[model samples]
Structure formats: C-alpha cells, structure tokens
Target: MTNVKLLLSAHRRFNDLLSALALSADIQPFLAKVIAAVEEFLPDSKVTILILNQETNTLHSGAKNNLPDFYNEAIEGVEIGASIGSCGAAAYLNKTVIVENINSHPNWHSLLPLTQKANLHSCWAVPICNSSNDVIGTFAIYHHQPKTPTAVEHEIVNVAALITSVAIEKRELEEKLRFNASHDELTGLFNRAYLNNVGDSFISLCIRNNLNCSILFLDLNKFKRVNDVFGHKRGDKLLCQIANIIQQQTRSSDIAVRFGGDEFIIIMENSNDLDGEKVARRIHQLILESVSNEILALDFGVSIGVAMLNNKPQSLSQLISRADQAMYIAKRSNLGIYCKP
Candidate 1:
C-alpha cells in the first residue's frame, strides 16, 4: 500500500477500535481489543497496556499481545518512579517516554534481563490521562529491534492512550454514581434501598445453606430531643459517631445499613440470636462511652432488637417488623436492653 493509503487505513482501524472500546461494559475485554488493534497497526511490535493502581502506587498489567507470560509477570506491579521502566516512568511523569535501546537505557537497568529474555530492544510509552489530566495508565509498544517510533507510530500510540483514558473515566464515573445511589451520604453505610434490594436474596441464601443468620434492628432513643436542644449539626455528628461504633462492633460478614432517620439495621451472616445480642450490647456500650466522654455528657443511647433467621422462618419484611416491634418494647422500658423476637 502507498504511504497515504496506509495512513488512511490506520485511521479507519483506529476509529473502529475506539468505537468498540466505547461500547464495551467491561475493561478487560476493551483492553484486549485495544492491544490487538495496536499489534495489527504495528506488526513488528508487541503491545501491552498497564493500568495505574493508586492505592498500591504500582502499574498492573491490563492487556498484552505478542508478549511472553514471564515478561508480563516480571513487569506486573512495578512501582512508579523516575528510574522505573518506560511504562512506570511515563505514568509517573504523565508524559510519553521513549527508550530506543532498552539494553543501554538506565531506566530499563532493572528490567534488562526480562526484556533480553523476551527479545525486546526498544519501548515507547504514552501516559493515559482522564479529563482532569490525572494519569491513570500507560500504553506501551515494544520493538524486537532497536528503533525509535516513526511519526505515524507515535500518533497511533497517542490516540490509543487518549481512547483508554476516556473509557476509564467513564467507567469510574458510572461506579461512583452506583455507589452514591446505594450508600448513605452521611454515615457511608448502606442505605435502606440497598438493604431492601438485597435482604431477600441474603435470607434465601441462608435458608438454602441451612446457616444461622440474625438481624439487629437499632433505633436511637429520643433522637429528636437531641436535635431540638443540640442543633442538627450536633445531631448529625452524634449519628455518625453511633454509626462508627456499630460498624466497629460488627463482623466483616455483617451488612450494616442506615435504614432511614435514626434507625439502622445489621444483617449478621452465619450468626445466631446470641451473636446478634452480643454485637448489640457492644455497640450500646461503645456509644454510651463515646457520647459521655466526647459530647459533653449528652444523653444518647440506642434501643436494640434481635431476630434470628431460624426463629422467624419468614420473609425479610416479617423479620424486620418483628424486630422493630421489639425495639419499641425496649425503648418503652427505659433500660439498656436488647429484646429478642
């Protein structure tokens, strides 16, 4: 093909690949297709995509084409630094990194053995950034022979990186929206909507596995009085404190939900009524101590009701209703109590 024709063909392929990536719901398959497209455009090069993990400050392999498994393993989770390999440095600097001769480059000193084993001699990487210009990943093309990327090859890498950034940002925003929909804004606990949506499935799972599960329903005592006297700000703070205490008292398997107003629910998997009561008591004790010590001796307490799955053997709504009724009983008694249903 003529040079102009080749350029036109590459642009068409790039557009087609970007369209496919944009419509993909999952990142893995999108990345796989991206690397494949890169390999097709640069037949002599191996393409790999690495995504930045902010929590670990490392680059993780997202996709690879024409690369050995051992080479991929060697570069996985590589910490980003000034002296790290092309992808790591590009991600850290938020810019393109071109290493024409990997064998002689100081940046690839640590990765030289792996690259030599894989017969890779050159690497060019472009940093992938989101709309906010935050670098999220790297798109790298490695050559078996020592050579710098041609102008057209550089254009292709840059466009691929841009496409990747758009896809990642879109996915992240979708995840954030989903999280906000199901979580309480104040206490960061699962909201009532989330609890209602999953409660039935959780109950069915417990029943099918013949496992014991319990629900602890909690209601803050005289919470309106606190808001009236202490202002809504203080009341909000107190609720947050209570939520933290409940979370601390519950196990990792428990699903804690802020079930509207001053009410909360905890679904304890593989737990009996006794276990639910223990958690309730611990939460009450912690709240009493926290409110007394931190909030100027304010009168804050919770009335808890415990219900076991085996005891109820009914719908989740019935269990919650029984627990709610039990909570009212505890509230009327004016005692630090956990009633069973």
Candidate 2:
C-alpha cells in the first residue's frame, strides 16, 4: 500500500512539472524546469534539449541540466546521420535510440570527443514530433555510469518529446501564418498591403545608412492583347511565369511584389554592383528569351521603368508616382527598354 501511495504521489508531481514547463512564458525558466523535472522524476542524469534549425538542417542545444556550457557549445552543429550519436541519430531516424554504453557504441564513436569533454557514458534520445508527426527536435538523457534504460525511463522520455514537439509546432505555424499574411497569393511575393505597412521603416533604414536602392516598376507589354488573344487562364500562366523570372533575377534580400494586374514591383536593396539599368536589361532579355524570335517578330516584350533612392523620401506617394510616370514613358517609347526617372 505504501509503495502504491508513493507511486501515485510521483505521478501527480510529474504532471505538475509538465504543466509548469508548458505554461511558462520565460524560455530559460521553462527549460530549467524541464531539466529539473527530468532529473527528479525520471533519473539522476544529464538532460539536454536540442532544437532543429530548419535552414541549416542541423541540431542546436537549447537547454541543459547538469551539463557544462562546453557541452552546449560542442553540440551546436550535430548533423543528422545513421552513425551520429544518440541525439543526432534519434533526429535522423525519427524515433527513440539508445546507446547503453556510449563509449563502446558504434553510433557514438565519432562523438567521443563530445563525450570526453562532457563526461558522458550512457545516452538515450527520442525525436520530438509535432501533431503532424514532423520531427522538430531530439530530447536526450545522459547517465554518468553506463546503464540500460528501463521501460519507465523510456516512457518519461516519450512524454518529454511530446512537450517539445508541441512547442516547436506552435511556433512554426505562427510564423507560417504571418508570412502568408504579408505575401501575395498568386506570386508568393510581398503584396502592396505589406509594402504600404512596412515600406517606410525599410526605406528609412536604407536612407539613414546611406545605402543606394532601386525600385523597378514593371508592366507586361500589351497585356490587354494577351487577354484578348489568349484566354484569361493563359494570361494568368504568363503572370506566374513573369513572377518566376523576377524571383530568379533578384537577390534574396530584394523584395518582389505583384503590384496588381500585369504590374510588378522589385525593391533592389544594397546595390553596389547592381545598377538598376543592368537588372532591368537582364529581365528584359530573359523575358525575350522565354518566348522566341518569332514572338519578337510579333513585337512582344516587357517595359520597365526604374527609380533610385539617393536621398530620403519626402513622401512615398510622390516617389512612387514619379516611378509610375517613368513606366508610362517606357510604354510610350515602345517595348524592350527600361527608363530611369
């Protein structure tokens, strides 16, 4: 009866700890709590939490208990692999993997340097998966003395994985939603709405730093003819193709936008070697390339007008209006050229 009573008390404490970790707003405190709970309820062990960096496809240490800062530093760039240590292996395999004696385990062989630095022996790792079953991180427990995990220990790790998974997924979804809101539906570029809201701050920073930037006002030549000759569906296809071309030509830091209808905007940032005319000419060349000489014989191409920022804007409305005027000038001059305003 006493043994059963003790077990019940432990279960309640475990639930409380999980709840506290989940509810805490402060990241460091929450991580500390998770480590403490794992140490008290699961085993006397070193606990490390790793979070995945999606861009790099690598794992980085997020938090730890009973481990040196060097352990955190050493584990910063663990890659996913079959022969990687328990945590990295779990991340690669998308499941729980245990190295009972890390010193002798084939998987942990290359990671011996990290173990030597951190004084590791037994290691168990489980992949933390989201509600969608995507692995977001790995939760690892290390024992100073070599030991095989019991079923209870495995269960505890699984629970920890579940918590980590939820946290990551929540963050990912929020970011995705924010991105969607800021971007255009058709071209996956920043919308006019996004620009209207955030343009001032970005442009202001460029001006303050004495940075030279260019804005291109692009319009598809005789797009009305395109709609009249081909169906609206074909026109949409052409627009998507144009968007792809714009994305290909511009740097990742540059902002592309489907300004509306057949019009597009490109924000050329930090242009040292990047002349607006060169970018415009390159885009014009590509558009011509995408079609053919036969299409050129038909006199079809894109007209682009560019404006550069040498000084801070008096008003964005006036600045954009001048660029728009330049675009009309390009249109009037005929296809296959860009005008600088």
Candidate 3:
C-alpha cells in the first residue's frame, strides 16, 4: 500500500514538471522548477543545469538549486574537456558521467576544492541533446554522501534532460522567427515593416523627452543603370556595401533601415540639423570616392535629404514627405545633398 502511494506521488510530480515545461517561454525558470521537482523526489541532493556555449566551447550555469554562490562562480565558464569534471565531461562526450565518490574520482581531482567547499560528495551528469541529437548542455545532480543514482532516479534525470532540450530548442526557433520578420535578409538591417511599426513610438519618445531628432532620406543615383549593366548579383553586392557605409556613419542609438529598393533611411535620435547634415555630407563623399576609385565599372552616387524635428511635426508622414521633397530638390539641382529650407 505504501509503495502504491509513493508511485502515485512521483507520477503527480512529473506531471507538474511537464506542465511547467510546456507553458514557460524561458528555459532558466523551467530548469529551476525542474531542480525543485527533482529534490522533492530525491531528497538531500543539489541540482544544476549547465548550457554549452558553442562560440567559446565553454559551459555556463543555466540554473541551480541548493548550490553555494562561491561554488557556482568557480565553475562558471568551465571549458569542456574529458577530465574537467562530471558536467564538463558529459557535455564533451555527449554521454552520462557518474562519479560515485568525488574524493577518489580522478576526473574530479581538480574540482575537489569546490565540491569540498560545498560539501558535495558525489555527482551524476546527463547530456541534454536537441532534435538533431547534438549535445547542447548537461543536467547534473550532486549528493551529500558518496552514492550512485538508483534506477528510478536515473530514469527521472534522463526525462528531465529531454524536456530541457525541447524547451531550449523551442525558444531558439521563436527568436529566429522574430528576427526574420523584423530584419532585411540581404543587409541584415531593419526592414520597412519594422520602421512602419515603430515610427510612431519613436516620434512620441522624441516629443516627450524634448530631444532633437532628424531623418535622412537617401536614394542611389543611376542605380537602375548599374543593375542593368552589372547584373542583379553585382547590384545586390553594391547595395550591401552602401549599407555598411551607412551603418558606420550612424551612432548606435540611430535606426538605419533599408526603406526600399535602392533607398535607405536613417532615423537620428537626439540630433539636430547640423548633425544630420554632417552625416549626409559624409555619405555623399564616401559614394563619390567609391565611384572615382572605379571599384565598379559604372558611376555610383547618392542624393540625400535631411529633415529636422525642431518644429514638432504633426505626424511621421509629414516629416518623411518633407525629406522626400528635399531629396527631389537636391536631384533637380544636381546637388548630392540638401537640407529642408
């Protein structure tokens, strides 16, 4: 009868963990709850989740329960290696690593000081793999006395690792989709949709803060001719190059967008006419130099128009119209850049 009650309780705990994992958008909080659930089933044990950073080839603590701050800090950013310790080795090998006795295990020799400080006597780690079967992290349990996991505990840890991998992969996919919707694929700059969605908010911010703001509208001169002569591939390369120049000349607070084909817009926050004109002149000069250098077989230039927000424009469309009108004037006068009169 007692065994039946214990099984029912463990089943309920796992069900709650699954519900939490399915509902949470973030991985850290889900992992924190996972450690708590594990503690409930297997008392007197500490749990931690470590994620592998591919760029650095290092492991970082993603979540933990009942572990000392000093211990976490010491093991943070641990480089993955065969002999580094249970979690590091499990991630490196893409397999489970069990150290029944921390004092005698050779893999834990260097990390003994940390375990001793935390009073941890043994550890078992399982690698968490994504849908592609690529190991992305590790789930580890540390006991207060020398021991190995029972069959039930081992099974529980494996299920937890699987759930963690699914949650992480889902979060990554959502982020990628969001980025794709907001950015231009060719130049990786914000697209017109993003500008259309956020323009009103930006104007409100400028008005509330009483800060100067300006916009620069630019169109590539004779871009159609270049596309016709050099082919579409080379035209795309040139546009990408121009995008880099615009990014370089703008401040971090500025919003640079690929407004449309052969057209770009720079929204300069906390900037006046002087600031906007300075950027326009720099862009004009860079385009002229690029053309003079004969980097490409054809002529390349840009006509720029600047609009200042000092007069407090009634709407974003009005400001954009003013800049567009100025651009046409610059084109008519054969001037590379012009400011609103």
Candidate 4:
C-alpha cells in the first residue's frame, strides 16, 4: 500500500512539473519545480541534473541539492571519457552508466582526485533524451555511503528522466515554432507577422508617450528581371545579401521586417523626419554600393520611402499607406533613393 501511494505521488509530481513548464516561457521555472518534485518524491536523495554545453564540453547545473560548495565546484564536469566518472563515462559511452563503488570502479579511478573532495560513495546516472531520443542532459542521484539504488529508487530516477526529456522536447518545439512565426525562412529576416504583432506595440507605446516613431517602406528595383534572367536561386541569394546589409545598418532598437515579396519595412524609435529620412537614405545607398554592377548578369537597387511621426499616426495601416505612396513616388524618379512621405 505504501509503494502504491508512492507511485501515485510520483505520477502527480511529474504532472506538476509539466504544468509548470507549460505555463512559463523560460526554462528556469520548470527546473525549480523539478528540483522540488524530486525532493518530495525521493527523500534524503542528493540530486543533480547536469546539462551538456556542446560548445564548451562542460556541464551546467540544471538542479542541485545538499552538496557542499567545494563538491559542487569540484565534480561539476569532466572531459567525456571511460575513466572520467559515471557521468563522463555515461556521456562518453552514450548510455546509462554507473560507478557502484567509487573506490574500486575502473571508470571512477580518474575522477577520484576530484570526487575525493566531495567524497561521493556511489553514483548512478541516466541519460535524458527528447522524443527524438537525442541525449539532452542527464539525471543523477548520489549516495554519501556506498550503495546501489533499489528497484523503486531506479524507477523514480527513470520517472524524472522521462519528465525532463519531455519538457526539453516541448521547449525546443516552442522555440522553433516562435522562430518560424516571426522570421522569414529564406532570407532569415523578421517576417510580416512580427511587424504586425511586435512592431505595432512599439508604435503604440511611442504615440501614448508623445515620442517619435518612423517607418520606412522599401521595394527592390527590377527584382523580377533577376528572378527571370538569372533564375530564382540567384535572385534568392541577392535578397539574402540585401537583407544582411539592412540588418547591419539598422540600430538594435529598430525593428526590420520583410513585409512580403520584394518589400521590407523598418520601425525606428524616437526618429523624426530628419532622422527617419537619413536611415532610409543610408539603406538606399548601402544597396546601391553592395550590388554596384551585375553579379551573375543581374543588376539590383532599391527605392525607399520614409514616414516620420511629428505625432504618431492614428493606426499602423495609416502610416504604412503613406510610406507606400512615397515609395511609389521614389520608384518613379530614381531606382535607388529615399523620398519623404
């Protein structure tokens, strides 16, 4: 009956972790809940979840409990090797691994120098993986004195790994979904949806505060000829190149979004007519310089239109329409220049 209740409690704890993860956009909240759940479910257990830093070959603390500062710092990470420790060996071997008695295990021998400070007796680690089964991190429990986990203890660790694995997978999926929603896949620039959602908020805030707001509408000149002549592949490459230049020229606070096919927009904060016109002109000059002549037998330039707020427009659509009209006028005069709206 006691074991049955423990299983029920473990099930409830896992659901709690998932619920917390779903509510918070950041990973920290989920980690905190996970640590709490582990404490509740596994009494007197020392737990640590170490996540791999692929770039640095180091491990980061996802969670930790009841470990001294010296031990925490000492055994945080080791190079992936068979003799490095249970974790290093598990990661290196790419499987669930253990060092039952740190004193005598071949794998724990090299890690002894570090583990001696913490005096870890027995440790077991299980690789946490996503739905795709790619290793993301590890779930570990350590004993202060030499002992192997009971069947029930190992089951609890397994449950923790399952919960963590699913959380990691869901978070990654959410990030990818967000990226797709807000950015252009081909040119890797902000998308129209992002402009409508986030860009409008900036404009609204500036208007409420009686501050400056500006928007630039730009169109690529003769972009169709390039797509027709050099093929869409080279036309796509040129667009990416142009987008990169625009990103570099725009201030960090400014928002740049690809409005749609062959067109882009920028929302500049605290920019008056003069400031707005200058940014538009700069982007125009940059495009002219970047593709000065035909590359792969194609020529390209851009027409820019600037709309600055002495007072913010009644709506985003109103500002965008004014800029669009200005772009049409600039397109008529010069292929690459900015016109005030």
Candidate 1 Cα misplacement greater than 4 A, ranges: 2-4, 204-212, 222-245, 269-271, 290-296, 309-313
lDDT of 2 by residue, 1-341 (tens): 35455446556755775577566544566667667777876556888888877677799877655788777777788788767888788888888898899889999887788887778899999988778777778888998889887766676667766766665665667678888888887778888988787666667777778787777888887777666776788777778888888999998878788888988887777556357778888988888788645434545668888777766454455556666777888888875555554
The residue-level lDDT of candidate 3 at 314 comes to: 48
lDDT top scorer: 3
The parts of candidate 3 lying over 4 Å away from their true place are 1-12, 26-28, 207-210, 221-241, 284-295, 310-312, 329-334
Top-down lDDT ranking: 3, 1, 4, 2
- Residue-level lDDT of model 3, residues 1-341, one tens digit each, is 35456556766776776787677777777777778877877789888888899889799887766798999899899999888799989999999999999999999998888889899999999998889999888999999899998777787788778877878788888898899799888987889999889887787788788888888999988898787876899889888988888988888778889999999988888545498889889988886676634533455668999888875554677778888888988887889888996
lDDT of each residue in 1-341, candidate 4, tens digit only: 48778878888888877887778788766776776777677666577777776666666676655677877777676556655677766655668776678888887776677667777788888887777676677777777777787777678788887888777778779998989998999877899888888876887888888887878998987899888877999888888988898899888888888888899998887544477778787877777777746652454568888877655355787788888888888888874555554
- Candidate order by TM-score, decreasing, is 1, 3, 4, 2
Candidate 3 TM-score versus the reference:
0.83
Highest TM-score model number:
1
- What's model 4's lDDT at 234? 84
lDDT of 1 by residue, 155-271 (tens): 878887887787788889889889989989899889988988998888888888888887888998778878887799988998898888888887776789999899999988754
* Model 1 worst lDDT run, 10 consecutive residues: 292-301
Clashing pairs in 4: none
Worst 10 residues of 2 by lDDT: 1-10
Candidate 4 to native Cα RMSD, angstroms: 4.0
